[model samples]
Target: MATATRRSSRLSSLAESISSSAGSTQTPNSRKRKQSPVATPSTPPQKRQRPAKLPAATPTPSAVGLMAHATSATKKPTNPMVARLADPQTTNATLLSPETSRVITHMNVAAIPSRLPQPSTTTATLLEEANAHLIKVDERMRPLVENNFCRVFSPEGLAEAIDPFESLASGIISQQVSGAAAKSIKAKFVALFEGDRRFPHPSDVAPLPIERLRTAGLSQRKAEYIKGLAEKFVSGELSAQMLNDARYEEVLRHLIAVRGLGKWSVEMFACFGLKRMDVFSLGDLGVQRGMAAFVGKDVAKLKNKGGKWKYMSEKEMLELSEKFAPYRSLFMWYMWRVEETDISTME
Candidate 1:
């Protein structure tokens, strides 16, 4: 009975100790705490801070003027020459005709300046005026003008003028041959006619046998060309009086249609025969060499490649010649002088 009683007490004591140990390990706030709803005064939502506005930009007077110019309803020029002249940057060259421009473009010529200088009242004569203007524009031209004296306007120079037929025929004969050889051939050609005339009339030449013309040192093709030119003259398709009164463009149009009369030939006739003032020929090798020399280019290096030069182009030639406008023929004469060549021999 005593053992039973002891076992029951020990069991009771062990059960109590386990219960107390578990209670000791338990957290004081085992349940989750509820969040408090504090009644603090609610602040108004903060507004976004705006950036300060910048002041409007004021345009400068020059900018305003440019804007006005841009908006203006001014009429623009239709012609290229006129348009170039309207530009303030353009300062030299005469206004070329459409025909002239076409030829230049076809030849790959340099650009000519569009604006011509106003005529000076200080000079007495046209030649004098041209001289003064050329000197004023290019100082290099002073020595050329002073030394050469522009005999092209003098009576002695004018006295050397031949008729249109002679001039053209002479040009044809002179093609691809030395000056002395051409003179020799021309002498022989003139001898073929019975009359004492300096040159044979186109009427007399039109009916001559090609074989007979060949006896005068003319190539078979050249003979045909000469005959064709004669026939045109005989048919009244070309006339001296008409050519004399026509403008340079008209002259170019008329002569360019003739057989064997190339642009270079026509240009030569205009410069030496017609005495046209504003004409220039980039095809002339003498002129090219002279121009090359004038601009400080090495003349020996200016080799002819195909139809163009090694150093200078036709376009460059035109640009270089632009400053001597309205008197390019005279300028060409002086260019020959620059090379120390006799311009008369070229004729």
Candidate 2:
């Protein structure tokens, strides 16, 4: 009985200890038992880092009254493309305010230097060759060719590059008419045909009735001249290629054989149109005057000094051209332009 009582007393002591420990683990005021205090790390409690402050979003007003008032005051958007085109000078005024347009007067100018596209191979070669000839004449015939025509003539480009077929036709039309009258008649002729086809092929132009052409614009005589030349071209009697290779004298002889085609017409064709360099038609009055002006002497005195050929005759022109050699055509252009200038100044 003593041993059993001792074991019962030990059991009661162990039960009492477990109950007290369980009571401590509960909340002190309310819970039946308390929880043990958990041991934390020795490091201080890590405070969570607050996210970096962000920009606050605009608050949408919940009041319907406020939103309705704002919507009523809003302006409609303008057509921006229409606005840009309507004010074409907008780019110029980028530095200025539209409200201050009336006050702005000075313009800002921007300048850039640009080169034209490179020329084709054929054109470049032709220019180089033509320039070589011009330079040769410039070296040898400096006094006559380059002095006066120095400003007017160019080897690589023409004064009339387009269908300036009319230059020859113009001299024909300008034969007796005043230049102004000839130009007016020419304008009518141009309008009668379309812009570029005014100078159609000879065979094509020849079939048209002469009177019809005159009514369109040419005079009876100019019409006759053009018709005669056209018929000649159609018949192969006066091929233009004659000027390319024939002796200067032979070409002139053949041209003058035609009723109305004079030495001057032939000269103009050979020199300016065909770009023949050997021609100098002394039968032309301008040539006479230009020669006289060059030496600062009287054409009358020049005529008197005649030995074999020294005046404004075909023979004399040839001799003078021999001295000027390779550049007579260039001299002719300048002579004409110079005469026009003198005439203008005198008038």
Candidate 3:
């Protein structure tokens, strides 16, 4: 009976200790626990919130834009030709012929100043400088300089003293003809002008019949070409002063419009007539042959795709000639000599 009573007392003490521990651990609001609300057919779901975007970055300046800015900052002076053309009185469209007007309208104003010749220097000084430059730059040119003296700058060699009209007329007559034949025809043509005027004036030539021009060994087409050239001169569309003062390219644009005056003819005029220094004629057979010989290229072996013999090509000739610039006219004069003489033999 005493053991049963003691067991009941211990059980009561254990139950009281457990109750006190649970009461000490519980929160003051434990009786009011919060619950998440369930979604119903009548209720809408909440949307998610996103982070805000940052601002865009600025771009760096481009090369072209920088170039444009620099160009504007350092403005170039206006070309004299451009300034002259800008004047209504100077470049009157109504006063100009259709051809002249067209040429003027299409002119590259920015390029005019660069193309114009600088102030004249003595021909002897020019030749001396060119000779030294060519010999120093190219070993092949050494023998050519030693063997031949450049006479293109000499009074007798230059056409500066000759009438521009006569020079141009001579060029037209010489086309497609041998040197001897050309000289003969030019003599006959000048002889038609009667008493001692050297050569007929443009005014005189303009009115003459094409049949009269043909009497001097000219073809029908050549006769027409000369007559048309004369008319251009007579009309004041072309003049000696204009040609003398104009840039090399300007002279080309003006003359190439005339009949029988192609790029080759204009190049000859620039070289021999105006005595321009830096001119090259890729079309001249003599130049082609000379260039081939100079570079040790055998024309027979240098054939095109068709296997036909070809001389130095225009591209190759241009690339080679670039080394002798500012004196290429003198270089071209020597090329003619290369054909007549064996330059390789000379020390």
Model 1, runs deviating above 4 Å: 1-124, 178-180, 297-308, 341-344
lDDT string for model 1 (27-140, tens) is 322332444454546955455434243221111111111211100111121322211111111112121111111111111112333374443321124466667767887999
Predicted candidate 3 versus true structure: per-residue lDDT over 233-320, tens digit per residue: 8897887656655666777889889987666556656665556677777766556667888888764354444532246677988998
Q: What is the C-alpha lDDT of each candidate?
A: 0.55, 0.41, 0.55
What's the lDDT of the predicted structure labeled candidate 3? 0.55
| Model 3 stretches with alpha carbons more than 4 Å out | 1-120, 155-160, 176-184, 304-309, 341-347
- Better candidate number, 2 or 3, judged by TM-score: 3
Cα lDDT of candidate 1 equals: 0.55
Name the weakest run of 10 consecutive residues (lDDT summed) in model 2: 84-93
TM-score of 2: 0.47
Model 3 TM-score, all chains together: 0.57
Estimate the TM-score of every prediction: 0.57, 0.47, 0.57
